[model samples]
Target: MYAELFRLDGRVALVTGGSRGIGLACAEALGEAGARIAISARSRDEGEKAVRHLAGKGIEALYLPADISSESAAQAVVKQAAAELGGLDILVNNAGIARHGDSLDVKPETWDEVINTNLTGLFWCCRAAIETMVAAGRGSIVNIGSISGYISNLPQNQVAYNASKAGVHMLTKSLAGEFAKNNIRINAVAPGYIETAMTQGGLDDPEWSKIWLGMTPLGRTGKPSEVAAAVLYLASDAASYVTGSVLTIDGGYTIH
Candidate 1:
């Protein structure tokens, strides 16, 4: 029954930013569960490499070049992936951008860039994915949020990044509420100080690491696979009744 509960044998999934870091981990995890994957990224080389990696694992992986910031591009990506993979059953909004700067020092251009990629791009992709999912009357969407959306970092500032992620949290809930009747599930995964390219800047800094570890109950950073596991659960039938939930993959940071 457990096998039947989580199996994704015939599903087609699209994971934005699937080339590396947390996104790649998720793509691999889902692929291992038997889903056909369409990995999207701005870099063609990285996208192809990711597809090769998934294929090496005996997963059907397709490379889709897309920058999720453009609404038309986002829709086109969904259409193309659906056409190539036959249909879409899951969407992981994993593409994001972060910039650290003083709230006062953050320029409008920088703020727009962060919001565009982190929040607006996510909306675009969701809209496109939802159009398809709504027609099919079933779908699952998982947005990758950040702990910064709830807690602030002291040593370095990322005002725009935090704002956009916070928006993502709200967006997830709103989308979930609106689409629940349509048999669509929307959720957000907020990760805290995970070991990934996004956190390399903070990881290399002793002061930042000290602060993060001091706040987290676990005393250590989380692995990409750990987060991927959470994503896999949320995307599977095991979580069929879960929706509008903000699943935190933090190392007990919020508990403290």
Candidate 2:
């Protein structure tokens, strides 16, 4: 009975930016757990390649090419995935970008780009997914937040990225409160120093790696799979009573 709660045989899930890294891992986890999967990303090539890889794993999946930075595009992808996959039972808002720049030196457009792509775009995807979820009377939405949302990173000037993730956390809680009556659950995962293409350069940098590992209680980089496991739990019936919570998977970095 406990194991059955994690099973999602007839459910459909949509993961934005699911072509690679953490997003891909999330897609794979959901699919392996028996949920029909659909992934959306900006790169058509990467999207197709990811779909092929999922096919190889025997997880039927769909690839929707879209830039979540556009509200229309975000909404369209959700609608398209729901139309194709039968209905939207789960949504993982993982499409985002980051940049390191001193607040004083950052351009207005740079700030806007990061905020728009990371925060506003995520909200747009949620709006579309929620509409479908409300109609269906049940849903789960998980946003990919960052450990930086809880604390500032050292040796990096990423005010915009930090701010955006903080927004994601609050938004998750706010939406959860508003939609719980609709039988929709919203949550977020805050990851720390996960091994991904986005963090490869920092991980390779001797100075950055030293600071990072030294701060983490685990003293190692986390895998995308580690984060995905948490996502899988939160997206499953096992977490039926859980919502508005931001599960932190940061190797104890935030404990400091």
TM-score of each prediction = 0.97, 0.99
RMSD of each: 1.0, 0.6
Q: In lDDT terms, how accurate is model 1?
A: 0.91
Candidate 2 Cα errors over 4 Å, as ranges: none
Residue lDDT tens for model 2, 48-142: 99999999999989999999888898889999999998999999999999999888999999998899889999999999999999999999999
What's the CA error at residue 18 for candidate 1, in Å?
0.4
Q: After superposition, how far is residue 138 of candidate 2 from its true place, in Å?
A: 0.3
Residue 220 accuracy (lDDT) in model 2: 93
Relative to the unseen true structure, what is the C-alpha lDDT of residue 215 in candidate 2, on a scale of 0 to 100? 97
Q: Ten residues in a row with the worst lDDT in model 2?
A: 148-157
